[model samples]
Target: MNTLSKKNDLIDEFDIIAKFFTPLAKDAPGTFGLLEDAAILPTIDSHQEWVVTVESIVCNVHFLPNDPFELIARKALRVTLSDLAAMGAKPYGYTLTIALNRDLSDSCYLLEKVSHGLTIDQAEFGIHLIGGDSVSTDGPITLAITAFGITNKAKALRRSAAMPGQDLWISGTIGDGALGLQVAKGILSKQYSDLAGRYRLPQPRISLGCRLSEIAAAAIDVSDGLILDASHIANQSKCRLVIDGGALPISESVSRIIADHSEMFELILTGGDDYELLFTAEPEAIQKIKQAGYELDIPITRIGRVDSGEGVDVLDHNGIKLNLLIEPGWTHF
Candidate 1:
């Protein structure tokens, strides 16, 4: 793979597909030989540790072809990194899997886009792209990435550790990505181009999530929409989640977009693609998060709490349950 140019043809096309990775193996299980640039598995002798996560971005499903290619690369890498951040992982490196359509002759263009995306993010996080795979197929373009980070495994935040009475919190604003895509499709207009930017290039709250691990009981990135991702944490922790409808932290810009459509709250609530972090913490930690200095342009809002039940409820300001046709957001049929 060429690191700097779009002219380098895709090479090292491995036909012998590697064996399917087990969940543990896929998680970059246990430490191994740690070199200066590559990962050196920590031992009883070494204090450093590692955590791994893998994610994929498919063209038709996760993004659109007309979407700026550079932004596409940014979104794909950010999503994978979001997963790493949720685990309180300090990024070390990443591996990519690219499946290009056979009809596309210039694999170089895709590589260049991918590299550009990685470079921008690496500058901020100090992570690197150490290795990857490139293959051709009849399917839509797909980019899969596995990112590794060093963290204390015992201290890593988990999705199943939320306790009842813990407070629920989200980083940054919600619903921009969902609304942004609508603008991109011309379903909406440039009147809300800022919203469209949210969809095309979700700024993952990486540092915030990493810091929250020090206090959060459980955490997840809001990729599958807040409703679905929150449900995952609720169900896993066996607690009921009560989210206050009005407390959702949507941008004023998104509110303007919704002003045109009236059904704005619904889209923001269920719309997927918002790569923010959703986490549960002890009530006492709420003030600390506010003081942590990670607030983005939009503020973090506390929407609900973990309760002693099995599902999530959306309540209005009066504490009445709100009616929603879409119970959970963005489920694949």
Candidate 2:
């Protein structure tokens, strides 16, 4: 086993992966998981390949320590599933790794609840657990999951395919997860329980993503905030992304927060963890995209456009750039 060692001190997650795990996959062709969002494994059949992604959630960092074990477990699984959803892959199965603190008397109960949560989502998404590992830890409880799916398309969607003149679109409403966190922390009113629920369980757009490979030029999940994630497409595709702030789709829960405090709009843009799909497609495919969304019963909205330039620009309805208070999205570093 490889460990991250910086003169015996641990470095950051990205650094650790790049220095340790990346080298392990050097000879493994198609195992670009370190360089890209997911790893692709070629199969015997030419038409399909395995798309695999893994993510870890910590007790206090990703979710509140005291949050329901059930919700935490669902989030742990769903976040990895969201990665598969971004690549237009169909769920197959997953492996879970849990580091538990044995000192807690309710550890068994918590494990039961987490397993129950996983069972519910597995049935809902039509996926199953293949294998996993568990161990005791004196530190905070941590959960890691490796999820894999299969895509029948000749090629899974990539973040580097967007081109100038394409339209930027998003599935489902935004800002719910960010606002939901505030609601969970009691920073905002609890009258908006939907917002809190959104924070707890994100609806991964798996069905819509499966259909989008043929329509979308590029796609990514908005786990790091809309502006930040859109910037990823911009940087990857070498095109400028201009998002219309006015065109942003907001749910009733988000609308309520904005109605009371307009400043919350910043949260809507930069707040991360929505896990919704943010994608780009040519204008000619707009009708087909909408048709697909309708068939999937998911609302798709066009809120921006790709243009010839650099970076991402967000403009108000008046077409004036709004000065941002902070960086566009969440950064682990």
Candidate 3:
């Protein structure tokens, strides 16, 4: 199981580790590469607790078959990293499990490109590859990542802590991920290629999350679209969230598309894959949150408020709650 022979060269999985993955484990103090079965945790503060999360991506399910391996690898890692961000944690390290298709001609080369991708992110985020597994699959190529982080023991953010007087805030713009999917599918014009880039790479709000642990009353990463993710917080907190449709922060790219095709507004509100942060904070914390966003240069928008109730409502500029057309979020099933 450790080796897969190719026509020109007989590089096995171990060689692949030596060439590509060994260096990634350097940052993790006790992980001496694939030589060991386990990895050690990142350096930690005495008062911090470990926060971990896992996510999987599959060909044609999470991404297109023709996607570059590097982008695929990066996306798979970011989704899991976003989970850590939602809890107000600092990324420590990550483990990866890749299932390669032996019959697919590109699988071997894909491993190299994916490793390069991981290398890029590891340097950018200061995380190391602690440990992982590699396997052969007869089906489509699949990869999973288990990300780890550290946060103040008792201060991790929660989705159930929101209160009636909290203001709903969102980090960064939305809808580009869905629009980007359209571009990838050829349903959209090439002029929207910028949007497609967004679908491929999501900017997880790690810096913002670290700053909001004590400030925000509740928080969640927006992976399953705005409406659905918002509903998660509202439902758990036993409160109603009134979102102003007009106040939703959208890029100029999406604003142009929705201007001519107003129907896209529903898509903007309900599309999945936008990895921005959705959170709520007390009214008194407004200035502090704004200041933090200003300092971090991450756009933080006040889009709504939490009220005493049980559901989420999206309102028009004129105060009418618009019934959106599609389901609010994405599901694996």
* Lowest lDDT 10-residue stretch of candidate 3: 1-10
lDDT of 1 by residue, 1-333 (tens): 212122335443231112211111233423221112234443522554678889888887889888877788778778888888788777776776777776676665665666666667767767656556556666788888888777765778889998898999888888888888888888887888988888887776667766776878999888878888899998899988889888888888887776777776787888878888888989989777887644434367788999998878889899999887465788767
Report the Cα lDDT for residue 317, model 1: 90
How many backbone overlaps does candidate 2 show?
A: 0
Please give, for residues 1-333, the per-residue lDDT of candidate 2 as tens digits: 122222323445465445434443444456553555445544536678889899999987889977899899999999999999999998777767777774666654676677778878877998765545555667888989998899875669899999998999998999999999999999999899899899889988898889997789899999989989999999999999999999999998899889999989999899988999999999999899989988998999999999999899999989998887488889889
TM-score of each: 0.85, 0.86, 0.96
Colliding residue pairs in candidate 3 = none
**Model 2 per-residue lDDT at 138:** 72
lDDT values for all models: 0.74, 0.83, 0.87
* Runs of candidate 1 exceeding 4 Å displacement: 1-48, 294-298
RMSD values, in order shown:
6.1, 8.6, 1.7
- Which candidate should be chosen as best, given TM-score against the real structure? 3
Model 1 earns a TM-score of 0.85
